[model samples]
Target: MTNKPDVSVLCFEGHKVRVLQLSGDPWFIAKDVCQALEIVNHRMALKALDHDEKGVNLTYTPGGQQLMRIVSESGFYKLIARSRKASTPNTFAHRFSNWVFREVIPSIRKHGAYGVPWALLHDFTRRSADSVERGSQAGKALVIRKIEKHQLAHEEKHLLDCFQPRLALGGESDAE
Candidate 1:
């Protein structure tokens, strides 16, 4: 198995921000961070901001290799600041900045990974189980309906067969 870099996803207001530790510093995916901050044009925003440019080759499951651009910690801050300035409704930018500064960065510094909350995992599992149960019930109901239809068809055929001899005789004339 190829050893992959230690990467973690931080949930910032329902947005997944991917962070990777490279050379003992936290580097974030430019696109993810930009998206969380509600930046419209990533290329234009990055071009306007003064930030370091770096790339990493990521192995995607079923997609082979992909190149992702990452920004240094300072670069990320610069981008955020730039985005905050450009954003009309600055709530997203503020929230993103607070989340990074208060939760993500501290978690990374202390544990080397952003610890995902257990509640989120538990909720996800419960929902998945409920969905599976509902699907199974629906499938069973469908099968039962099909079986009932088949039995009804069989009964109808039996009734038709019982009258077949009578109908055959009635259609013939003695003079024929």
Candidate 2:
């Protein structure tokens, strides 16, 4: 696909990996995945992945348009298989893979469909982000006034807020 991929930067244990799900599961930035897996040389790791399993994607970011090397879900598994912690349970690699497979992929497949009108979807996305940022303040005015909901304490609200940092990295439960 020549169209620009919708890239999302996901932080895993402080390492940020970019993902794009256009039709199937999603492709992850090879370099980022390799870094997350603690592989010293991404080029060496990428050389082992099959042709169809790897691809190049063009993504638009605030910095500018850039070409990124991406790996398919299968290629990602290859990288994980090559990881030192692949056979170990509850390792960082395993947890990161689990986070992507269990949490990220499912969510992407559910909401990343292209049926919605582009303009409306774009507006909604922008507004939703703005809402989250503004509502995260002391009073949570949106929830209290607009949604007419219960008042949530700081700790209770922070654990599951839009800007939640814990669950985004290490807190997500791994089924394995």
Clashes of each: 0, 0
Whole-model lDDT, candidate 2?
Answer: 0.71
Candidate 2 on 1-176: residue-level lDDT in tens?
45655555676666677677657456877888887777888888898889999988786544566787889989988898778765467878778877767777677589753223333444666899888787686457654664444444554686677556655655565532
All-Cα superposition RMSD per candidate: 6.6, 21.8
lDDT of 1 by residue, 50-126 (tens): 53454443633224556776777787877877775434455777777877778877876898677453345446757
Off by over 4 Å in 2: 23-25, 89-91, 105-176
The deviation in Å at residue 110 for candidate 1 is 3.4
Model-by-model lDDT, in order?
Answer: 0.70, 0.71
TM-score of each: 0.61, 0.53
Say what the RMSD of model 2 is: 21.8
lDDT, model 1, position 49: 55
